[model samples]
Target: MSMVNQTQVHETRLSDAVNRIAPSGIRRFFDLATSMDNVISLGVGEPDYTTPWNVREASIHSLERGLTAYTANAGLIELRRAISTYLTKRFAIDYNPDNEVVVTVGASEGIDLAIRAIVNPGDEVLIVEPCFVSYAPIVSLTGGVPVPVPTEISNDFMVEPEEIVKRITPKTKAIMLSYPNNPTGAVMSRKKMAEVADLVIEHDLTVISDEIYAELSYDDEHVSVPTFPGMWERTILISGFSKSFAMTGWRIGYLCAPEPYASAMLKIHQYAMMCASTMAQYAALEALENGQEMMDEMITSYRQRRNYFVKSLREAGLSCHTPGGAFYAFPSIKETGLTSEEFAEAFLMEERVAVVPGHVFGVGGEGHVRCSYAASMSQLEEVVERLKRFNAARIGR
Candidate 1:
């Protein structure tokens, strides 16, 4: 035997699933942005604003009172009750706090728990791409195969019901959706949502709706998929305080679903996470209770940014559709004779401007780059100039 010692018999390495998960391509640009000085970054998706004062104050108070004990595995009842009321009043969606809700570390966790709860090994979950980077990998981690359906900018990236139905097979178990979508700020209309709801009902498929950006809508009120007829029983609604309350670091979110599903998600959640941060839960409770004015103010700022930034991209000779929701603007760079990754790298390396390459978000994302308007207006203005200059160098503008 060639040095086959007992210690060498066991190899410490990542599992196949972990190794197969595609790394977030946004991070490379982010690392580059961090290492360079005098660079204006519109790469990361975090809001530039600090958490609203009242929300921060509540968490501080919680700390001062030494309220650091572990909450119920489901989370504090008070927070759950607040969320229950908020959803009912705001979206006309009702869920009993006792059996239908579970607070998660973030909408991210809620999504993971919900998937692991429903998807069996080899089960198929339909996802719309250029979507959130985490959606596919998370599904894979649960031993469920992620099936992506392409959605394009020509149609504004709305998930079509026909495309979904064509992809459905006997192995199909659920559809995962995020709208207003990340990377492209597309928000599905209520009528279109109803159509998808009908498809789900027809297939008897479940929908895991990630409404993390629901409060950031610039047009009509955000619609929840579960609110449609007969869809409630099949939809798992996931949202959180991060976007609206500017509480991204708080890691607080919740999921609402009917019995068994909610109960199932909670079981995974309780064992995996124990509970979300107690102080953050209290902070989220405060956000739900008293942060409306602050949330509205932030949404107003994002709306202004969206209008200005999208207009700038169009005027600069790039094709960009004004997003109806969220803070990102995804514009095609194909006309410049460069792929999304090459464009993003050259744009950063030469102009000292950083943005995320679109392909990182999955299908229908290539030939474009995702820019976050969550940065300050000054940074955004500089970004437009740099992007225009970069485009001119590569292709006649």
Candidate 2:
């Protein structure tokens, strides 16, 4: 009779997939770095540069003109048109502005929308290991199972076509590819891309290609996977100004996909976010139209830093590859006799320098750590000295 007269109670029903998803290891290290004073962070994957002055001016202009209302679910006509021209001019891909593009809150939201639009319960989505953290989680949340294909350091982390072919099953619905990749900074060559395109066509699987760091390609020119034959109908090209233009806070990104897919994605976006920020959209349009000069300058700087950091890693006795694109340097920390997490923690505590543990990226990432060189030259020099000191002690032992 204990509480027998009470009203009925109900238990919460959370999806099993939601409960099973792992948190980003990269973010955990970043949080740890923030709590420690005097720490030099190379953990977060963000550009440290200021937003271009011209982009800022555009936003201010929009505000002064009293353009504050919700424009359209698809986005402002002017911005979409600007994106159309920019993509064609830069990547040689064609998309109709009226039906093929949808502005997003960020490439992050674009990813979520893409997953939601295509995935049904229990469908399979192929992903490359040491990929961006959000891809797998977004797939799970959409009730799509993530099938990870591990890339090798010996191969420079480029996905092998045979590996992709081997991983595909009848349930596979889509594949996600990111080049000028985070963590590894590996880029797919044209021949490699052609192989992937052939596979995606053969498998009849959709593709979500994250090319956010497209403009940061150091060794080779960046190309859109969608530009390859047969990929146009099956690919969603995701990019933004955040990494390229140092406009991370602006939070405006866009996706270009074939229609019906684009329309469905826009529906999800309409309900979930309504639209990207009106002010940010204006700034992003300005970025597309006038930010190329700014990009040339930043890319030149990143290339210089990339060269310096790669040499520093080798001189410090760490095993590393020459990254072709992006601002990160992923190097093996195994020789130091510490697990990735142990190496990260000990380095932070003793040297006051923080880097993301590679295991956070996936099984293939063990024994490695990602160091972002997006910081200033002075900061890079300081971190290099700290790493050298750490390596000297390890060698002495």
Which regions of candidate 2 are displaced past 4 Å? 1-13
* Residue-level error in angstroms, candidate 1, position 219: 1.5
Instruction: State the C-alpha lDDT per candidate.
Output: 0.90, 0.90
The sequence of per-residue lDDT tens digits that candidate 2 reaches over residues 314-345 is 88889899888989999998899999999999
Task: Supply candidate 1's per-residue lDDT for 350.
Answer: 92
Residues 21-113 of candidate 1 have per-residue lDDT tens digits of 877888888998999988898998888889988889999999999999999999999999999999999999999999899999999899999
- Residues forming the 10-long window of minimal summed lDDT in candidate 2: 4-13
Against the true structure, what is each candidate's TM-score? Answer: 0.96, 0.95
**What's the alpha carbon RMSD for model 1?**
2.7
